[model samples]
Target chain A: MQVLARHNVAVSGVEGAPVIVFAHGFGCDQNMWRLVVPAFEADFQVVVFDYVGAGGSDLAAYDRDKYASLAGYASDVIEIVEHLDRAPVTFVGHSVSTMIGVLASIERPELFDRLVLLGPSARYIDDGDYVGGFSSADIDELLESMDSNYLGWSHAIAPAIMGNEEQPALAAELDESFCRTDPDIARRFAAATFLADNRADLPRVSVPTLVLQCRNDAIAPLSAGQYVRDHVPGATFGQLDASGHCPHLSAPAETAAAIGEFVRA
Target chain B: MTQRLEGLPADVLCGYLEVGDDGVVTSANDEFLRIVDRPHDEVVGAVSLSSLLAVGDRIYLETHFRPTLQLHGEVREIAMELVRPDGTKVPVLVSADMALGKGGQFMRTVVFEARDRRRYEQELLRARRAAEEAEGRARRLAQTLQQTFVPALVPDIPGLEVVGAYRPAGDGSEVGGDFYDVFQLHSGEWVVAVGDVCGKGVEAAVVTTFVRQSLRALAVQWDDPSQIIRALNTAMLQHGTDRFCTLVVLRLLKEDDDWLVTISSGGHPLPLLTTADGEISEVGASGSLVGVLAQPGLADARYVVGVGDSIVIFTDGVTEARGEAGSFGLEGVLGVLEAGVTSAGDLTDNLLQQVLDFQAGEARDDIAIVSIRVQDDADEAPAPAPRADVEAKDRALRALQELQELERLDEAE
Candidate 1:
């Protein structure tokens, strides 16, 4: 199968430049990296793509059984890396994909030069002494909230696109204008993202790694960032001055500069 | 913030806040202060959006809420639970909109309590879950009923190696209306019949049961498959149900070193015959459907099962299965069988697995496959190789090797 077309992959930047692959988090598509990708275009070959079922990917290629866990998404990252046809990649994974990049690097170490985990969390649910954050009940509430929000959003967005039926081209583009997901798929993805426990896979990350933690992150606590740095050998943990889960959107300049400094170092 | 905040309900609590790009609460209305239970002076320029909720709700807000508002310019109807000052969890629907102000882009957000809507949605969720559980139970019962329709074991018929496998459609979620049975009569004749009802679920399962009963009873009295099918048609017409079944009945007789196979069909697919040299051909004749008219037009065709020759009879589910390219019709079945097999079990398993591997996902229909072989003096014959598939594999391996060599040469240079 053509994994490129299946993933709706887009490649850009100057030829022969060092390659950087950006994997977006759950709930949205590659558009989540729009603010961060352009900063590297001058000096790097940037590759941005969508995870299946979330963006303009070939929906038919999505298999529910394969994608029940994070490994399936990790496999897609490896496939994308294998098709890069250049030097080892500088992989940037946001949110859930941070763990996905870690897993992919463990499986194929030669494919990557550096690992950048944006707002990374190894485990979301708290265990005995590890405070990964959240509980089983909280995860359920998150899924329920997602369902209600998607229901209202779909109802509001559908007619606005349909009203411009005179231009079918614009309507087709507007279909994915908002990174909307089918509710059932989003629920599964949310469960996979929030319920995954990947603390054991930390020691296996052999590549040079960067853990970028936001100042006021609720999804991944400050303790979680320290845990990642302490666990992964030779990993450097840096603090971004931005808040919330996505510093790339809230503080793209700072996020990009921190990454550039680390890559150059 | 220049845009006017209007068109909201007066009674509903609407909190307003000016959020910085880094998600700090730069400004707040009295309603916002009351929602977070923080004093106006303490809240502004000091708190982030995630500071209002408990740890769990904070996670939800950070991952889902703010990212959406940042990217889409607005996030609507976000249901979040805030920890009130008195340590009570308040379920509220928060909506936020962001726009550019004088110095930087700031957001104006509103929060509304969703206690009543939450209660109504909880009731609806409970109802939906209960209905799903009941459906799961009913489907299990239908599957149990379907199991008793086919024989638990194929009777040990001497002088013939018989193997059959039945795969229900959708992995036993729905009761398949297809069934098959094999047994030896007292007069030394082996009688086998495979049939499928027109529809599915309990109703088709009922038709399958009736057809099995009629075929087993009629085959004992009459030797010819045509006569047995005619009697079955009459029985179904008299039973007076709006259901129909397609059937293929075979009578096997071992004569000398060969087995004589006589088969008749009632609007069923033709049986495939695989010879010793690994060639497949369609045998048997098509006839009128059973239970459709007063005089059923079923026809019989004679086929010989020599040593290393196998006969396969299956339901329409096998022919109608879809793959990446298209349906695996008659030609697809032949392509699978042409690889040849040593015994009945080999052919039966090979065909089922190949049909499944032809598609990336699950088979879309119920499959019933029965293959009978006339064993040689030796218990098993060596399975014949499919020339085309083996050649294809060889070519692919060679191409991979060449590609690896090219990569090595590039590295050396």
Candidate 2:
């Protein structure tokens, strides 16, 4: 299936070492793990990849029906792990990808050794008694904000953002290319991420799991993180001093330290 | 001059503010303070920039805006809304850049009121969504209209393997003018017809339906292929429409161990005949176009297709399909046949796939193909079974037959 090329998979660190696969969240690509990846390189074989419709992955492979739900994204992860031929690897996921990792691990429990969910949320919209931190109307408003900002992302910078092979240097020169995605694809991904309900799927996890919550996180609040930790069987909970949804980006030292301690233990 | 310079930041039309690394508002001009409707003392050194944003905008800041700024050193013209102390929202366009200072890294930002621009952009977004929805509805309507012109399933004709394929031009959003049908006549003979109308979209679709239905209605009454084409031409001429169509009709009748095939064309491409020995040739005689002339030249060609022989009929969409080299001419069709396909399904599939690949997967015209092969005896092998298996197989077969009968009853309704 050319899984490595399809996801733009990048592998580094020691050969034949314990593997750690990092999956990015909805807004960005594998580059989100740049700071933390360096911390794992000395001892662990670190892997990172862009999901379809993001970064340098093949856009022709994006199927609207296949990617309409989080299951489609989970299938990609399973394919990557199977294709890597590496079983029982540790998985680290951020934001919406945390739920994606959980789904994948549950579907193929033998492929994963442990799961690290950073700023995880089982649901983003508030339910009857569950406080997911945002209302349904707020998510709609977020989609609107995405639409308004798409004006700057339209044609002028799209070629560079797409990492055009003809002008590789131009794509490489743009630091913003990591988070920039095709606006239409991003809109679909946003809906699939924020509107997903995976609360019921939590207790099905059989792997050893760790939930890391960031203080003052706006997207995935502390309560949502606690809900995930409470639901997943034998899941350990930790809190980071980082003040945003992205601890790997905002506080890479502390974030990597916590993950390092857990993996080593 | 010094006093004027100090007042410049306060008097500017856009609001200016600065935030420390922790996102706390460390400084704000009078204009910035007024935009959020907060006193400078209460806003600066106390309020965080993220707290001033609406909930949705706050998420946008954390997910998109902040990441972009941290990576690119700046973010420009991001649309967001700020919540005032009284809860009124103010639409604003914000641009910010991060820089290192003596106090540590801080962000300098400029905010401009954009209520009018936001309203205009919202209108544009709504219009785009409306246009997309209308396009989706039209495409579905065309598809349903197209299905009425083309038969859904060809009846299973004994002793003959019949297969047909149709591909719409471009994205299938507009109705294509190509259609094919296979049906049984009252005389127990089978008729296969392929046609192409003059144009595309709703107008051509109307003519296509008229021509196809008229042909089917006339076929049952007449036994000769040439006579059928003639009657269809006269009916189209009297129908009072300027649109014309090209057609080829074939009549198949089982005679002893072989099938007698009769073919006629009305300004349509001739159907191809493939013998078991790998011989390929055109079958039908050329005739004048239907509906345009009072006395259109029409004639029938006859051939006996024995076991291991096949016949293929198609629209000009196949022969006239444009490719990088040129049109996929009659040679292309012969080339596919020359590849030695064994079954009716294989011939139709190979021909269509070659044409599509030749055009790099985009069909410039609608393509319709129908292939009929005289089956070899060895092709239909009976199934072997034990006593227990036979009983189970009979039960499953009875269930399938019942389901098919129910489906036919539903269609009748």
Candidate 3:
């Protein structure tokens, strides 16, 4: 009950249905999964909730100590699973949540069955020989970009990448309805997200994993996605034809079809 | 001139391609031809949309774009860079969805150039980063400067327990004018004082520094609280600084195996004194503001306090503190004191917390608190003889001292 209130947990669809928990990425809330979740509701129980400080999650529940790293958020995911008394369900995550799901699966394997990593990157910044796409300098620029462009963050990054040119309303709808983050939480989350290197935890994930490598995803690039797929043990790698970090939003039906096929398989 | 579609414009930099089941561009309009920086014939039945993207982007198409286009026949605001014929990149946003014709379902992509917008976003990002860096630097400097002037920790004195804390106000952006001191004299007496200089910023802080220095110097000359206040007044008048303050100087003296508190006030709030039986009341002398007039006569109030009893001295920042409701007035302060505290340190901390909590962790004015209590070891166990454990503890103490020194160096850096 406490965890539900804290993270604003929402459950819909058939109660006894197989559960599918959707976790949104950085600069986003559970609503980012809205485009794809409708198709899943008919078959699977859809679960969506915000991490503290994002979307409708209680901001006061955000503790800097607990939220200082990805492990903190993973605990929340595990808690939500425990809170609902459901586990070994389909866990789909986008961007940072992809690794968050990975951490949760490792910490409590009983809580998840299949892991869907959307635009997952084992590491974001370039290390010794690993090519994680963005340089440390580029990350600094991204953080600075977040700082300078308050509303333009969603406007430029969300819309530009998603190409709302056809129906600008969709981009505007996302701006008003999703990816809205508290500034302080967003900044700290940005630090935790980009600076994190979860390469070591990949091979430890014991669950069946699927990597959805979004084409032309600037934030979570192709190589990064491929790196995660290659490292994770027994992980099936499938390339999505959709462009941008959030295939779930940009190309919902195709993203879902892949998950549906994988889950059934 | 060609008639544009309802929402589509010629200057919009838009294009459409009929991508077949194999994901090859079977046909393209001239505008679509111009956007990709390729000849119409070259793209027709020859190239796929994935061919126009970077390698990393092509992988993206394999995973996300193509599948979505295949299933839903559309995608939106997909950020990708298209390679023009000249090899220069055009950073554009593309939107594509499928439309059915006589052939199988094919995808049509619309493109908008984003070079200018990207540049603007980058500039905004840079400015925001610069501003954040400046704020971080200023905070570091303020913290360092705050530490340099004030005592970082309360002085540890045996028998006489002292708890001292200072909370700076307003996000700690600027230095406050509140100052406190907890030091023991050579005469076995502890001198604890709390003061708030009028106004704020560097000027008020300068006056607070003067008061702190002058009070410490005067404590050497006299043990009487009233005389010390008078001496501070004389020194401030001689300095000719146009500043004033509210101060309370308290001397904890031991006599006849009992402790007596001699307190002098300079237009400050009276200190709270509660007995061992929970009888609480304000007890302190009164006088005009310090350092203002040439002549300042401050009275002294001496009282005997038993063991387990405490008195709390604080600045107006406590009682005058603002909360969501209103100011935590004298009544509010007394209420906190009424709920008896165990130790002097705890009492001081409790009172400080009440004010801080009242305002929900926001300190609008600088606050200083001093609580001195007598030890309650009357019915204690006898001392044990030295053992091997003592040697271990001694080594541990030395290690702790070294670690503290290292910490001090870290702070200095």
Residues B56-123 of candidate 2: C-alpha lDDT, one tens digit per residue = 67876777677656655666777778889898999898888887889978899999998999789778
lDDT tens digits by residue: candidate 3, B198-299: 887545655666787678789999878889988898888888888888889888877644688888999899888877788888888898789887788789
- Tens-digit per-residue lDDT, A1-265, candidate 3: 9999998788987888899999988766777677788888887889999899886888889899999999999999999999888777899988889999999999999888999998898888999789887788767755664454444333423333355466566455553434445656777888898889999999999999999887766667788988898889989999988765667755788998998898867
- Evaluation by TM-score, superior candidate among 1 and 2: 2
**Tens digit of per-residue lDDT, candidate 2, span A1-265:** 5889989999999989999999999877887788899999999999999999987788888989988999999999999999888788999999989999999999999999999999999999999999999999989977776676565334323333453464456447654457677878887888899999999999999999999999878889899999999999999999998877788877889999999888878
Best-performing candidate as measured by DockQ: 2
TM-score of 1: 0.71
The DockQ figures for the candidates are 0.29, 0.31, 0.16
Tens digits of per-residue lDDT for model 1 on B62-141? 65566656655566666667777788767677777778888588877887877788778667767776688767766665
**Residue B187 of model 3, lDDT score:** 91
- C-alpha positional error of residue A158 in candidate 1 after TM-score superposition, expressed in Å: 7.6
User: Over 4 Å off in model 1, which ranges?
Assistant: A57-72, A85-87, A125-178, A182-188, A195-204, B1-13, B30-47, B53-57, B81-83, B86-92, B114-178, B186-188, B196-201, B213-248, B261-413
Report the poorest 10 consecutive residues by lDDT, candidate 3 chain B: B380-389
Q: Would you list the rank order by lDDT, best first?
A: 2, 1, 3
Residue A88, candidate 1: Cα error in Å is 2.2
Candidate No. with top TM-score = 2
Minimum summed lDDT over a 10-residue window in model 3 chain A is located at: A152-161
lDDT, each prediction: 0.77, 0.84, 0.75
Chain A TM-score relative to the true structure, per candidate:
0.90, 0.92, 0.89
Report the alpha-carbon TM-score of model 2 versus the true structure: 0.86
